[model samples]
Target: MSNEQENPLLQYIFNNPEEFARNLTKIAENSGKALAAYLEPRESGRVQDETPEELSLAVKTLAQVGEYWMKDPARAIEAQTRLWTGYMHVWNNTLKRMAGEDSAPTITPAPGDKRFRDAEWEENQFFDFVKQMYLQTTQWAEHLVEGATDVDEHTRHKAAFYVRQITNAMAPSNFILTNPELLRETMTSNGENLVKGMEMLAEDIKAGNGEVKLRQSDPSSFEIGKNVANTPGKVIAQNDVCQLIQYEPQTEQVYKRPILVVPPWINKYYILDLNEEKSFIRWMVEQGHTVFVISWVNPDERQSQKSFEHYMQEGIFMALDTIQKTTQQSTVNAIGYCVGGTLLAIALAYMAKTGQKDRVATVTFLTTQVDFVHSGDLRVFVDEEQIKLLEDRMNKQGYLDGSKMATAFNMLRSNDLIWPYVINNYIRGKEPFPFDLLFWNSDATRLPAANHSFYLRNCYLTNNLAKGELEIDGIKIDLKDVEIPVYNLATREDHIAPAISVLEGSHCFGGPVEYVLAGSGHIAGVVNPPHKNKYQYWTNDGLHRDINDWLNTAEEHPGSWWPHWQEWITDKDNTLVKARKPGARRVKILEDAPGSYVKVRL
Candidate 1:
């Protein structure tokens, strides 16, 4: 018998044909059920029909794009020919190498392309061909996406994204045969790495409730207070939803108006207070600002019912009241990061509608989006079907698990976040290095189901927040009603909150709005300190409706935007006073900074 026929499992299956048939039948039945579930349309009243006017507009847009592309048919043919020629050269080189040629034509990886970095991939002719072919395929796919004119911009973008994902997934480095490092280790260790990987996989499956958990690092390697959120502070106030942390002043004197930082609950609050060097909180404190951050509690089933209104009231409102009372300052300057910025804007609107606009002196938004129309790739996951699936999962768990949410974000940059860790941990049998940022990233926090659902539906899906249709606590909050001077900071490379979307939202406010575009992605842009002397920023006094017009006219400023922000905040008021301690008369110290709420693990 042949090797395949002699296999014990195969022989048994062949002999017990009825049993094999039964198993196949069961598999088919399960697959059909899964397919049915996936195709099922969600029940949502917000979904609109494709009207003739909308269809006409879409058709016109497609035609315009098509006409532009078809203006030069020869150009398209030339590009395709070039790609074909490159593929042919690669195939010829591969065949030559197979015929035992000493030298083979190989393409070098692009700058910063870490995949195919293994010596075997670079030296081995087979792997060299595989890498070159993959690169060529990716280039061709991207060219096709760029050339496509039959679809809308969003559709084209999604197609490109999926194409990249498929190409990345099929990279030779992910396989055992093409992965030199993995092969070397397997031979040296006599397949021990495989056994260890299996063990780890089993352990993770058990711990993660059947989910395949790709551990970024050894969780025990880092602790909350010691290496991570080590900044000195005290929790002066606490509520059901969050705890207010008041960091000890570094300088003798601080700004007269205390700064209240509202961070997104989607992540742990300590991201701002990470380490002293990279910590924005530390930098702000050293810059003579009395900073108070809201540490949102890691919600459990009990807090799943907490609504968006509850977060605004019990979180931001409570913190603001505490800061005002403690510092004895009627108005405090507020800075909001990410979703926290969105919440702050809502609060400002609510306060304005309620005739309490003076509660905040000035507002600063760090990569926040109120206008969801151009919110970037995250919109792909906000549709009715996806939202329904997410809602159902959240309903079952009472809250959205941090890992589950992280998966969606990680998929946005799968090449960077997912594949590297997979190769290092499982394929190469190595643990990820103890990086604080990665550690913090892995330590995600859960979102309360009610609040998350409301946010996804109202803000992202319907985009009521920017339109002033968002109502909270029996009050209609309008962004135009917010008369407070706003400092809107957006990152050029931000995927979550696009700068254009931020610019649109900034225009919604009926006040003096200064929009600044900083370099780098979301987190790095906001946390950047001036001393690092990294990442330039752009600014313009003119407020133009067109984003490109503003970008074209804006003056480029070197280094970090921190100094500019400091100057802006300082210009707000000339009053400076001795720095106040962590807790004041009204708000006594409860616990040290970083706070208990931030340390909670879901």
Candidate 2:
């Protein structure tokens, strides 16, 4: 008569007790491996203990906001009352909906919320109540943070960020008991999913050497050079910092100016060369460009002494020298993405200081920042308190582990990146589908101590580059001195480099800037190809204004901005030259395309 009895788990448990017991035993064994995977590294002293500052920073930041409410009794009581009111409404709605009144939800999930996609989160009374309660509780939490206005700007941002992390971890969708889809699967499989999931947990822990490296895609399904980054090219030259690869030309006659790509070292350059369909590098080659990309080395203790000056001198500048020799050209067009763009901007200033500004004829900055005034949430983790802690950790190994940066980026979009994997892989015991972008995302690279430290201190911490206070190799470089034509691109919904920050950087430049806005976030927006036509782009209506002002009068174009970029680049210099091979002129071919450097995995 009872629902539990009628829908009994493992309906034939009495007959299938043998298989059930075997699965339970497997789970127990796998759980032991996971524990051992975490402890063995510490026992052997292979991994050092990190400072407690990381944990304390979150606590202290939250305390600042808590102190705001504690100072006023009315504020504290009002927050509690607000929470209780929301709970009461959720309860009332649950009762009405249970009685078949079609009662509307007390609060709805945000537009793109994928958590409540299951019909049971709404059609079923119990699950619906749980979903509404979670939404209401999130609203209450948001109210508490918003009301703490007395908190300083940075501290408040950190508190709100911490709150979101805590709330995301507590979402009901993360647990099998609270998630309808997970619960149904658990019961249907008689808990075999839990056993397999435990096995996976142990594997990931072992792979990370005591940390959990959640598998975002089926790793077995993809390889870097074979599937994901398989573009036709050859490595022309290599140094300690990077290897320069020149793609085989797709067109008989290519643009005279060779394009050298300076990609961020935080992640692999394959993001721009994902696959045939999504390959931005391949697309550029097809657009009659002789594409050359610098594949930065994954750092180690050997590169501990490498600084920002060294990266400019060895990485970007070295690639520029090689590009000139390989293409037999005096000048080249340059493209810089993210942090790489920042370096190119610095190099431009340095070039101007040395009277060599014409080395790179025209430049393009893709989601790069010279000013950090409006730098997004990443700033919350870059304060003196945290950077000091980070430096201390880096001193132990000479390089910041790639995973540390990767984890921080994921935290920015925890609901989409972290929780979803926790549910699908750990709870549902299903492997995620093969996705090129996520595969590239998981492939992170280490950051050398000197380079990372100087960057954080100068750019993120001090905003020196914008103020002309940045000194490189004992030279005070100025952006205004290097007045070359620039094509500045910013993604509309970027979390790392916000459009406003990119817009502000446009003002810092002393040249004519052709600013364009693309729809989507950092990666997707930049990598979009014209044929795919996935997203739209906006160009200013021949007026120079701020982001908001420009958006109001911008000309919206359908599809990717690649075609427009091709047109813009060619108009500058449409002269055609015979397609150049990887090592036709001077630089000797060192290796095949994608290079040995990118094949080095973390």
Give stretches of model 1 more than 4 Å off: 1-89, 96-111, 119-123, 139-159
Candidate 2, poorest ten consecutive residues by summed lDDT: 8-17
State how far residue 48 of model 1 sits from its true place (Å). Answer: 32
Error of 2 at 384 (Å): 0.6
Q: Write the per-residue lDDT of candidate 1 for residues 256-306, one digit (tens) a residue.
A: 999999999988877887787888888889889999999998998988899
Q: What is the C-alpha RMSD of each candidate to the true structure, in Å?
A: 9.4, 2.4
Q: Model 2: which residue pairs collide?
A: none
Summarize candidate 2's per-residue lDDT along 1-602 as a digit string, tens digits.
86546764433233455776888898899899999998999899897656466778888988888888888999888888899999999999988877778777899999999988987788667778888898899888877777788888888888889999988898888887778788877766767888888888888999999889988988888987899889999998888999999999989999999999999999899999999988989999998999999999999999998999999999988888888777778689999999999999999999999978889889999999989999998998888888898898888889999999999999999988888987778777888888888989999899999899999999999999999999998999888876888999999999999999998888887888888999999999999988787899999845454677889889999999988988889989989988888888767889898999998878
Q: State candidate 2's TM-score.
A: 0.96
Residue 221 CA displacement from its true place in model 1, Å? 2.8
